[model samples]
Target: MPLKIYNSLTRQKEKFIPINPPYVGMYVCGPTVSGESHLGHARPYITFDVVLRYLTYLGYKVRYVRNITDAGHFEEEGREAEDKISKKALLEKVEPMELVHKYTNLFHWAMKQFNTLDPNIEPTATGHIVEQINMIEKIIEAGFAYVVNGSVYFDVKKYAATHNYGELSGRVLDDLLETTRALEGQDEKRNKADFALWKSAPQQHIMRWKSPWGEGFPGWHIECSAMATKYLGARFDIHGGGMDLLFPHHESEIAQSFICNHVQPAKYWMHNNMITINGKKMGKSYNNVIKLTEMFSGIHPLLTQAFSPMTIRFFILQTHYRSTLDFSSEALVAAEKGLKRLWEGYENLKKIKEENFDLPDDNDLDKKINSLLDELDEFMNDDFNTAKVLANLFEIVPVINSIKDGIIEKNVLSSKTLHRMKDALTVYLENILGLQSLSQNNETFDGVMQLLVDIRKEAKSKKDFFTSDKIRNQLAELGIEMKDEKDGNISWNAV
Candidate 1:
């Protein structure tokens, strides 16, 4: 089946046809690096990572470009034009780039922990100031932008006269012009709907660059338009971000890019829904934003325990990308258990070898297994419905477990069917879903832990209470917990 994706632009699911077949270009808005990334930031990155993975899996040469906003992002839109990075730097008593470097490295570390593939081109806003300036100049040359006292502002009223300014956002131009009231200090703009292309830097502003208008930095929306155009050409295949950016940020991007390039920036626009906490949006004002560091370290008040990156990834995938996912300790713990169970079944399926060749002893069971396996692709093709795909995988898990336990003979499935099942499980779980084992990835650590488990088992068998207690206590002190199962099997997990 051909892949179908829900386009936010059209508000419908459409077949994904690349502008250039056999090649796809994708750009996702990266984080503003003034502060560490939070739980709200994880949804878009992981969602787009899967999109990139699946496109490549389908034999498309995909060039993924995700930009870093290290400068010129304001604290709030249309309120005060203070740069987010510069304001944070002043409060922390550090250089703007220093704070940018620190948070950028931290964001990279978190993405690595989530096992997300790095983008083909990770452009930074500060690095591409020249490109941004050039784009702004072209907009001014086209008579769509005007300079006011050393600052550049896009003429939204003028653009709306000839073009659909709020098409992507489903907003009416008249309503916006009527409702948007000018703030006390923003009287320089001709219309309240006009947005900043470039802001003039004050004397105390640290992050400033020379421009025709004056010494200033690019606006939040212009940085993305400039970087995406430079890296992905005049127009790209897919442009994605969180749904919250649909209004002023993405709307302004479309206006600016269209004025400069004479065409829309991206062919398809995708957005992932936000992650909410306690039925409220995760934000600084709500006091519910959980940073990635606090999430992994269990230092946040909302988290019950430290969650592994894979568990969080699995949690996000459990819901459709377009649906809102609420955050709670209980929900995450359920996801943890679900991922653990699925991983066990996956490992067991991998251990089954097709050494014995036989026809299906049970035709009905064989057909059922193949049908479940076949639906994996079908679900994913239907707008990348990962939640449905995962549900089908869970249905197959019992079959794998029954086979492993000898309740169902492995010979019931032909060699070809068994091999296909194994391959499908591995591909969907590890490659497409980007999940990893809950245990540590180090082989030496595994070997040492296995040795300790064996030693503890032998001590238990011989009734050597002292040695077993010492072993368990020492391992527990090191944050490892060994459990004796009812089946006389010992398993260990990191605390």
Candidate 2:
């Protein structure tokens, strides 16, 4: 089946036909390095990481470009117009670049923990100043922008007259013009809808650069347009980010790129929905922004216990990317339990060796297994419905466990079918879904646990209740729960 992507621009799922066959270019808006990344930041990166992985699995060479906003990102654009990095640096009493390096490194560490693949090119906003300036000049020459008080602003009203300003975001220009909310630099703009291409730096601004519009930095929106054009060409396959950026940030990107390049920036636009904390929007004002560090360490007041990076990744995948995921201790705990169950089933499936050459004795069961395996790809192809894919994998897990526990006969499935099942499970779980074993020391830990299980089993067989009870009690004290299966086998997991 051909892959379908839900394009936010058109608000429909369309067949993904790359502009260049066998090669695809994707750009995702990455984190601003002014502060530590929070749970709100996890969704887009992980969602796009799976996209990158699945495309590669489908034999597409994808150049995934995710940018780092090391500079020019403002805190609530139009309200304050203060640079995020510069503001944070002043508070921390450090150089702007120093603060950027610290947070950027932390962001990379969090991504590594989540097992997200790095983008092919991670361009920084500050690093592409020349490209941004040239693009701004192009917009000016095209009469889509104007200069005021040494600052350049996009002529949104003019652009709207010639082109659909709200095509991507569905925002009407008339309403924006009527907005009475007082904003910084409102007097300088020809219309309230206009946004900055370059902001003239105040004397106290430490992160200023010399530009044709005097000494100042690039605007938040222009940074993305410049970097994406330079790396992914004037047009690319996909441009992805959180739904929050739909209005001004991404909408402005569309306007700027169209005016400068004379074409829309990307063929398809994708956005992951926002994350909420216990039904409330996650924000600093709400006192609910859980940083990735706080989440892993369980240092935040909202988190009941430390959550592993894989557990958080699994939690995010449980819901559709387009749906809002709510974070709570209860939801996270449930996700943790679910992940453990799925991992255990995966381990059991891997241990089953298909030595019998016999054909299926249970044709119905065999067909059911194959059907589930086939739907894995179909679900993924249908706009990357990872939630449905995971559901199907859970259904197959019982069949795998039944086979391992001797409830289902080995030769019931043909050798070909068994091999296919194994391959499909591995490909979907590890490769396409991008899940990894929870711990690196899992092998050694399992070996030790298995040895203990065997020792207890021998003691129980010899009718020595004392030694068996002692082993069981000690393991229970260590928070390891062991279940004695009906088939006289032992299964264990950490409680």
Candidate 3:
């Protein structure tokens, strides 16, 4: 079956047909770079990362673009016109660019920990000022924008008279006009619903640039439309971000693109749901946000233990992208244990080999195994239902473990079928899912562990009960388990 995607624009599932065959372009909104990335930021990056991987796996040359908002976007849009970066920098007593550099590096490090692929082009809002100016000029020339007192505002009421102003957001123009909140620049706007394309910079503003209107910066919404159009052309294949951006941010992008390019910006609009805690959305305002650094270091007051990066990724993938993933220490612990089990099963499957003895095929068992492997692709095609795909894999874990424990004969299935099952499990777990073993994999670490094990064995042989017990206790406290086998062999696993 052809891939099906749930388009937020049409509010339904539609067959994915790229405008240009075998070549797809995707644009996702990136971080604002004013602060460290938190748990909430992981969903879209991981979600779209899987999407990019799956498309490439299906033989498509994809160009993915994610932009960084390092300029002009204000805190509390339509109100103070204060740049988020500038405000944070002032409080931290540093240059705006210096702060951007610091947090952008942090964001990059966090994405790396999550194993997300880097975008083909990571355009910054500040880097494309000329492009933003050019696009705003086109909008003004097209009679959709008006300049007043050195600030340009999109004429929402005027544009609404001719086109569907709130089509992407499903907001009625009349309702928007009636409920428009008063902002700092409301006196200059003809209508309250009109959003700023360019805000006139006050003398104290530091991130000002020379635009057609005056020395000001591009508004929050215009930066994305300008950057995406510049890199992905007038129209692209898919536009993705968090569900929180479905309004004012993405809605304004649609309006700006229509005015400048005479068409919608992208064919498919996809959004991932938010991460919540205790049924409330996790944000800085609510004091519920767990920064990625805090999560990895277990420095936050709320975290029970430091979660491994792979465990966090697996936790997020356990829930559907469109569903809210509630956060808790218990849930994370469960995910950690579950992931260990899954990985153990995968490792066992990799070690299985075909036996030379030929026996009648167990058609029922073979069909069950084959069906589960084939359904992995089907579940992914259905709007990237990763949770379902994982569920199917979990069902195969016992079968693999059974084979490993000699509960099932290896010759019950053909060699080709066994090999195929191993390949399928590897592809979905490693390639498409982008998961890796979180345990240390270096030679130094391994050698140190072996040295410790050898010392403990020698201590036991010498009847030094105190030394051997001390070694075992210390290793257990450090999250390593040592097992004594019936043959006097010692094996270890990092808990």
Candidate 4:
């Protein structure tokens, strides 16, 4: 089956056909870099990372671009065009670039922990001031933009008369005029729905840049349009971001690009659903955002314990990208346990050595293995259904365990099928899903643990119960769990 994607623009699933065959361009809206990234930020990065991985796996030369909104955008759309980064920096008593540097580094760290691929081009809005200005000038020359008091605003009413301004968002012009509230600069705009392309920054604003209009920062929406077009060209293969951006941010990008380039910016528009906490949307306003650091350290009031990065990744993959993934301690714990089971099975599969034997008595098990392996690609091709692929992989776990436990003979399946199973599991788990084993083997720690396990064994042989129990109790208190195996061997793991 061909790869299919649900384009938000068309509001339907369409077969993915890159405009330039064998070479694809993808642009996903990146972080604003004004504050620490929270759980809500993880979804889009991880979602598109998998999409990029899959495309690359299929032999496509993909140039992925994700931008950083460093030149702080406004607070509220129709209200005072105050820069978000500048205001936060003022309250914190630091330079605007200082804050941007702090958060941009932190955001990169979080992305590494999440195992997301780095974009081929990570253009910052602040770095491309000339491009943004040129694009805005072109729009103004096209008569789609008008300067009001040294500030530029897109003429929505004029653009709407010629083109459908709200087509991407499914919003009608009449309803927008009726619903938009009057703000400080509403009188300057011909219509209430007109959005800013650039805002004149006051002398007090620290992040101001000199533009044709005046000393002001680019508006929230213009930054994306300018950066995306500069890197990905006038028309690209895919444009992606969070669903929350569909209304004003992405819709405005479409309008701006159409005015200057006379073409749609992206062939397919993809959006991942938002992450919710408990039952509500996760946001700072709700006081429910769990920062990536807080989640890893288990420092948040809502988290019962620290969750490994892979566990969080697994939890996100369990839900379809288009579906809202609810965050909860219980859900995370379940994902932890499920990932542990799968990893354990993966290790067991590694122990299945190839045997030089004749064909199996029955081909039922062999055929089933091949069918399940083939289903992995089938599920992924169906709009990247990661949950179903995971389900099928889990089904193979028990079969591997069964073969290991002697319940099924090794010769029942040919060596070729066994090798194929291992190859498939490795590719899907490590390459496509981007999952790694959470447990690490530190040589120094392992040496100490082995010494302690040896001491315990010696104590048990000498019938010194006190010493053995003391070692066990103290290690338990330190979050090290020692397991006694059936063969009298000891193993320890950090809890």
Candidate 5:
């Protein structure tokens, strides 16, 4: 099946056709390294990670770029942004650059825990100040931006007159002008619709740099447009971010490119819906956010218990990208149970004996399984419907378990078919969907555990009740658990 992606600009799913066949370039808006990433932050990165993974699966050489916003953007007008990093430094009593580095490393750590693919290039707004300046110059040269009090602002009216400024987002230009808050920025910009390109730095601001526009910093939206174009060229295959950015942030990016290069920057625009808590946005202002580390450690007030990053990944994948995923402890618990059973069944399938897959083959179960696997490409191709694909996978857990229990057939499948299915399941679960089992104890630990279990079983068989119970009770004190299976064989797992 051909890959299809829902284009945020077009507001419809379209066949994915790369600008250059066999090669694709994608850019995603990454975190601003001002603070620790939160649960709300995981959606877009995971959304695009699977996009990158599946494109690679489809045999596309994909170069994925996601930026880190280290250069602080304007939080309000007339006042310098308490520089995102500098302000963080002040609060934490550290240097601004140190704060930036700290959070950047933290974000990377969180991404690593999530099993997200590292982008081909992680351009930083601070590092690409020159590219941002150049892009601002081009916009100025093209008469779509003007300087005011040392600050540069995009001329929204002119750009909108020439190009469809609201193409990427459905926001009407007039509505923006009408509804724009009459704030301090109203005086600096020519119109309410205009946005910052390069924000002039005030004396109070310390993160200033010498630019063509005097000592100033690039605007929030300008950083992405500049860096994406610099690394991925003026036009790329896919650009993605959270839906919150679809309006002013991503909309301005399109306007900037149209004004300077006379074209949209990306062929595909994808937006993931927000992760909400109690039907409200999970944000700092909302005060309901679960910090990524908090979620990982189960230290957040909102989380009922701790959840592994893999369980979180599975929970996210069970929902469509464009749908609001309500934050719930119950939902995560369900996902954990589902993943545990699914993964355990899949693991056991590896050791199952295959005398003859005839019974299942006679029922055309292999064909049915293949048919489901075939639809994975179709589901993923349709704007990366991870939810549907995951649901399809969950539907087969019973079949896998039945095979492991010797209740289903595997003999009919040739080695190639069996291997293909296994690979598909692993790739989708681990690589694309980014799900992994909780890290298990090391081999040495497992060996000791097995030895303990063997000794306990031997004691039980010989009716050495005191010794067997003592070993079991001692291990339980150390948080080890044991379960005796139906066959009287003892199985132990670490808690």
Candidate 6:
């Protein structure tokens, strides 16, 4: 099946075709560096991270660009007020860049913990000020931007006259203009509909820069349009962001790029549905967010218990990206158990060797496994219906477990079918999905565990109750909680 994507621009699933053959460009809006990212932030990135990995796995050279909004999105007038990052730093008495650095580092660490593939180009808004300035200049030279009092504003009314301005987000220009009432504090802008291209900095603004518009920073929307065009060119393949950004943020981007470069920014306009908590938007403003760290440690008041990064990953993957995922402690606990059971089956598939199995001359195991594998690709191709793909995997899990436990006839499978089944499981589990076991593979760690187990075994053999219980208690505290079998061997894992 050909890969299809749900384009927010078209409001339909369209076949995905890269602008350039053999090379694909993807731009995903990344974390804003003013604060630590919450669970809501993880949805879009993790969704597209799989897209990037799957594209690469299918032999496309993909350039993935995810930006860092470190120094943008702040108040522009009145008291020379601080930018978001700067304001937070002042209230906390930390250096401005220190906060950016800390959050940026934390975002990276979180991505690593989730096993997300690093983007090809991770640009920062502060680093691309020159590019932003250049784009602003182009828009001005093209007569689609105007400057008033040293601050530049995009000429949205003028741009809309020529371009299909509302084509991307389905916003009607006339209604928007009619609904936009002038706010009390805005004297510099010619129109409320015209957004900031370059915001003039007042004396109090800490993250000020020298721009064509005196000392100011690029607007929140302009930074992305500028940086994406510079890194990916006038147009690219896929542009993904949250569905909430489809309005002012993305609408402005389309207008700016069309006026400045005479082209649409991307071919596939992908937007993941919003994450919700108790039917309300899971957002920073909503005050119902579960921070990624809090979710992992189960420290937040909202979460019932701790959840591993992979459990969270599986939970997200089980739902189609275009469908809203509801958050609850019950859902997370269910995901944890589901992932553990799935991984156990995958491990068993590895342990079952073809040599030990009885086989017919031409077993149909290959056909069965091939059908499942084909469905995996089929669902993914159908607008990235990840939920369907996961359901298919669950269908085959019982078979794999039965093969390992000798509950089913395995020798009836031919070598070719066996090999394909193994390959299919590994590819889907590791390569395309970008998921891996969240456990260390260190030999030293295993050896130490064995030694401790041996000590406990000796204690049990010697009838020393206190020693055996002490070892068990210490390991449990360390998350190497013990699981003993009827045969007397002790197993442990950090869950």
Question: Tens-digit lDDT track for model 6 on 143-232?
Answer: 888888778888777888888878988888888777876642256666667888887876777888898779987776998898899999
Query: In candidate 3, what are the lDDT values of residues 1-495, reduced to their tens digit?
Result: 789999999999899999997999999999989998999998899999999988988888899999998995666745677877888888999999999999999999999998889999999999999999999999899998999999999998888888888888899999998898888888898998999899899887889999878899887699889989999999999999999999888998999999999899999999999999998998878889999998898888889999988889999999999999999988999999899889878877887777633544457778888888889999998999999999999999999878876677666776666777888988888888888776755788889989988998999999997988888889999988776754486767785
Which ten contiguous residues of candidate 1 have the minimum total lDDT? Answer: 355-364
Model 6 TM-score, all chains together:
0.91
Error of 5 at 209 (Å): 1.2
Give all candidates' CA lDDT scores.
Answer: 0.88, 0.89, 0.88, 0.89, 0.83, 0.83
Taking every candidate in turn, the Cα RMSD to the unseen true structure, in Å, is: 2.4, 2.0, 2.4, 2.2, 2.4, 3.1
List model 5 lDDT by residue over 1-495, tens digit each. 699998988889999999997999999999988888998899888888888989998999999999999988655545535566677677888888998898899999989988899999998888988888889999999898999988899999888886898888787889989988764456888999999898888787778888887998887699889888888888989999999999899999998887767778999999999999999989877878899899988987768988888888888888899999998999989988888777765665565544443343423676878888888888998878998898888777787767654465446554544555677888888777777765467989989988988998899999998989999889888867676665477866563
TM-score attained by model 1: 0.94
- Residues 199-299, candidate 4: write the lDDT tens digits: 88987888888998889878769888998888889999999999889988899999999998999899999999989987888987788899999999999
TM-scores of the candidates are: 0.94, 0.95, 0.94, 0.94, 0.94, 0.91
Error of 2 at 380 (Å): 0.9
Q: Give the higher-TM-score candidate: 2 or 5.
A: 2
lDDT of 2 by residue, 111-166 (tens): 99999999999999889999999999999999999999989999999999989999
- Encode model 1's per-residue lDDT on 424-481: one tens digit a residue: 9989998999999887747888899899999999999999989989998998999888
In candidate 5, stretches whose alpha carbon ends up further than 4 angstroms from where it belongs are 76-81, 353-362, 409-417, 463-481, 485-490
Question: For candidate 2, which ten residues in a row score worst on lDDT?
Answer: 72-81
Better lDDT candidate (1, 2): 2
lDDT of 5: 0.83
Report the error of model 1 at residue 283, Å: 1.5
Question: Candidate 3's error at 87, in angstroms?
Answer: 1.5
TM-score of model 2 vs. true structure:
0.95
Q: Looking at model 6, which ten-residue stretch has the lowest summed lDDT?
A: 74-83
